[model samples]
Target: MSREFEFAQLLRAYRKGILSEKAFEEEMTRLEGGACGGFIAMGKTYASERDAIVAYLQRVRNGEAAGARALEQWAQVCKTDCMRSGLRTIAEREAYHVRVIDRKLNDLGARCEPAADPEIDRFVSMQSDPNISDLDKLRRITSSFANADEVVKPIYEFVDLIKQDLDAKEMLALWAEDEYSSIKWFLHACAALGGAAQSPADSRHEAMASAQTH
Candidate 1:
């Protein structure tokens, strides 16, 4: 096969999760008469590795097998490179990490909104941190509202705290106004709190007999 065809096949394989970096490099080396020269030649035109990867990923998304493989390979390389380099600004690193998490969540068929369990946990953990700002907390809460299931407890607890702190009925009124969704969540949270509020014990054998009767 031509070098171009072989490279394209390698790219497709990588995208499909079939090729390892070592394996890809070995093939490229054998084909190009040296180690990674072919791939390096392809990579040199892009301004940044990330930009190149993004371009390849777009091609992959467009059903180009070679581009898809190149994108996947580049992603792995970029992640490792980022970790090893320690050159990224804090904000850049955080944004990149969040994007990675977002992609994984999307792949899992999760909503882009903040409703999932892990997303809620992340927000709650951040809120509990003494270093986090109130304005940031408000932002997170607002973003979280779009996916209410994940933030209901935190929202209730936060508003409840505000009600106590301000000694005002306004906070309570605001909470009450969201009663339909909040009440159901509150009930569920209460049931989850263990002790006397826990769900009733169920006998598996009794449930089986009941099911059989039906």
Candidate 2:
């Protein structure tokens, strides 16, 4: 059977509850044959790796743009000197990432579709609220992931699946490393604010500081 027909059958089975969500995802991953690189590209399936990359880049572009805006707004409201500096630095990096990703999407002959995310809107509002302490905002953001590395692990995994798209793979690999640095900073900032012991971010602080200077 064709991949399309097989995907349809799987979708029907999943919808009918014949397959659990995990099983359905595994089957979809198998059907894509690594076109999606075994990672759910924003929870959708694509027939080809290029298609998946195009869609994934669009999603990342959107998310990074939102993140940049949110962090900038948070920086404005943040009262702490160090937190404000770090927030602005991260915001700038996120904006730069979006620009590069947008260029890549254009090279692939695709335009980003404007997708509004309500969760992002709420997050921006929360982050920008002057009444919220910087520690609280740090807690809110860092709490989403179990650890710093968890945030960027999927990006590296996806990069590994790119068998032919060396350009995209290299780009994503660098992007993942950047995200790792940002998350490490966030975790360390949170810990310091909460009076917890010094975290692993201490070792990487010099690197993050170097990034800020750039």
lDDT values, one for every candidate = 0.39, 0.80
lDDT of 2 at 137: 88
**Predicted candidate 2 versus true structure: per-residue lDDT over 5-75, tens digit per residue:** 77899899999999999999998877766544543455666667788898779878888988899899999
Error of 1 at 50 (Å): 51
lDDT of 1 by residue, 1-214 (tens): 3458778999899788799988988877766652233222132444332333333323222221222222233233332222212212322333443454345334434424422355434544564454653334334434424435544454344344321123222433343344334334323322332211333563433343243335
Q: TM-score of model 2 relative to the true fold?
A: 0.72
- State the local distance difference test value for candidate 1: 0.39
Backbone clash tally for model 1?
Answer: 2
* After superposition, candidate 2 runs with Cα above 4 Å error: 1-45, 195-214
Candidate 1 lowest-lDDT run of ten? 79-88
Model 2 Cα shift for residue 210 (angstroms): 22
Candidate 1: residue 110 Cα off by (Å): 26
Report the number of the highest-lDDT candidate: 2
